[model samples]
Target: MTRPLRLHYAPDNASLCVRLALEELGLAYDSVLVDRRAKAQKSSAYLAMNPNGLIPVLEIPQGPMFETGAILLWLSDTYGGLMPAPDDPARAHAVQWLFWLANTLHPTARMLFYPDQYCDGDAEGLRRTTRQRLSHQLGLLEQASHADWIDADGASAQGCYLGPLLRWFALYGGATDWFALQRWPRLLAFAERAELQSAARKAASAEGLGPKPFSAPIHCHPPEGSAV
Candidate 1:
């Protein structure tokens, strides 16, 4: 850990999740903008780092890492404190929710935001179905029997992940009219609380997200790159 980690990011993209975790962990790192406005993620340099050509790629001592969830989990496990310790009673529940967000909620968001990538026809229909599914998924989170994984100070990597997903749900997916965080009181409450975390505050300032980025999102006016 002699050198700081390097994070390749777009201003308000999924990299924000990794950014939030790094801030919370108090790790100093450098950021390289991917310049989505220029399709920089698809460039040869970036593709070499990640064949999938996604927005975030964390350059660590081991090598360049892709996938937001894997980066978050690695930071948590490598540095600790971002989740319940591996042997703790709460650890299993903590990891489960992290995977659910990554595996379930996140892919659904991708389908909604970039429908063309998921299909060649009926893109609108895909979004229509996805919106309904997103609602039901949020409802499951709202009604989950336990949220100790995320409840304390937006402390886990999952909270960092959820906060951005919440923002994107209202801001992306074509017609956001069907979505409202207020409909799920607990999640809305989580957004309200998550915004107050020091890490979230730093992210807002760095990415031109307003003070209420999570609880009440507006389209980002990033200092450097485009969100889309």
Candidate 2:
């Protein structure tokens, strides 16, 4: 067998998606932790790998893979599982959600939680605006989640898959409530299942390495959206 892949990641940020994807794919990979709080991501060594200094860099046999969503697509395609079979409608559906998580939901969520980190403008003003935007997008997320999708219990449900965001919301407070999440048991169940996976739990444990105060914490529209 070939040697395992090498993965450098920071668990406290959006890198969790790639971590979970690797686990689901049963890929053997080594982990390198980046200290987000210390701004280690901006270091020259890391910048050489990814100018953006983002986490969850996968050093595949062919080359380095950056960006979580892109990595997810590559892993699913390269390994063949966790997503719908190639060209299936569900495959498109999976990519739809993945990109929504990547482009719209994830960016919005980060802006809300860490506006100060990204912006040097009025921090309080950014926080207020971010909260409002977050609330509105969350409303959209609840609505879409309640429509229809695969559920945790293997039953059909209209709105589900908001479980990951619900957990984050529950930890942070504000946003919506638990009833909305329960509307899709399988989605919640899926989150729970994925959460319990060894790699995911391990990643969670690694988050503690960030500064002591590092508690971690998205949205869509008239066109409908998902949170990261």
Candidate 3:
């Protein structure tokens, strides 16, 4: 029997990261979709699990894990094939990319995507700036995507975990025209494979998380070398 994991996530939020990981790992999981719009995450039930009331809390075989990065890491540690061995240098590379997504790229993209949180007035200007900044990161991601798994020529294994995040980036940054990523058929193919394997799709045909309107203030600033 497959041991099921419990994942608490908003239908639209940071929870997508963990959900994507679970899907990529091919693990059976029961997802509790917390409606952040209704403040369901702040309810007494969820609060008992995560005092911070964050989305993407994972209840693994070991215990509850809050925060998107932690949940992903836990899955990597607990499940084989999702991550490289702990002693492998590639494992460090995976962790580095994970943190880069969490601490830098994700936060930057959030700010650009949701300028309503930063300023009350006309957000169009902020959006343009954010888009420009996002483009630079996407460009970096495109170069990074040239690695083993993404590059059709290479036989190396890599995290296909960046798929959803890149999809979101393309959606927001208007970056579907990126030549580098487009040239990498392997990466696109990998994303499609992972998306098809997602639990949300199998269970209810849900598309996992979609882009939500954000109003949370960005706690982090745009990284240097960002076009914005």
Per-candidate total of colliding backbone pairs: 0, 10, 0
- True-structure lDDT of candidate 1: 0.91
Alpha carbon lDDT at 204, candidate 2: 48
**Higher-ranked by lDDT: 1 or 2:** 1
Q: By TM-score, how accurate is candidate 3?
A: 0.69
TM-score: the better of candidates 2 and 3 = 2
How far out, in Å, is residue 33 in model 3? 2.2
C-alpha RMSD for every candidate? 1.1, 8.5, 8.9
Error of 1 at 4 (Å): 1.5
Q: Which candidate is the best by TM-score?
A: 1
TM-score: the better of candidates 1 and 2? 1
Estimate, for each residue in 1-228, the C-alpha lDDT of model 1 and write its tens digit: 377799999988999999999999999899999988799999999999999999799999898999999999999999997888888888888889998999999999999999999999999999999999999999999999767754565478999899999999889878899998899988888899999989899999999998899989998988887888
Candidate 2: list runs displaced more than 4 Å. 1-3, 117-120, 145-150, 153-190, 197-199, 205-228
Among these predictions, the greatest lDDT belongs to 1
Model 2 over residues 1-228: C-alpha lDDT tens digits?
A: 566787776543455566656665677788776766667778998787788877758888877778877877787778876566676766666667667767876676667556678789876677667666666665565456423343433211111123334445434423333224445444444555544445545544544421111112222111111121
- lDDT-wise, the better of 1 and 3 is 1
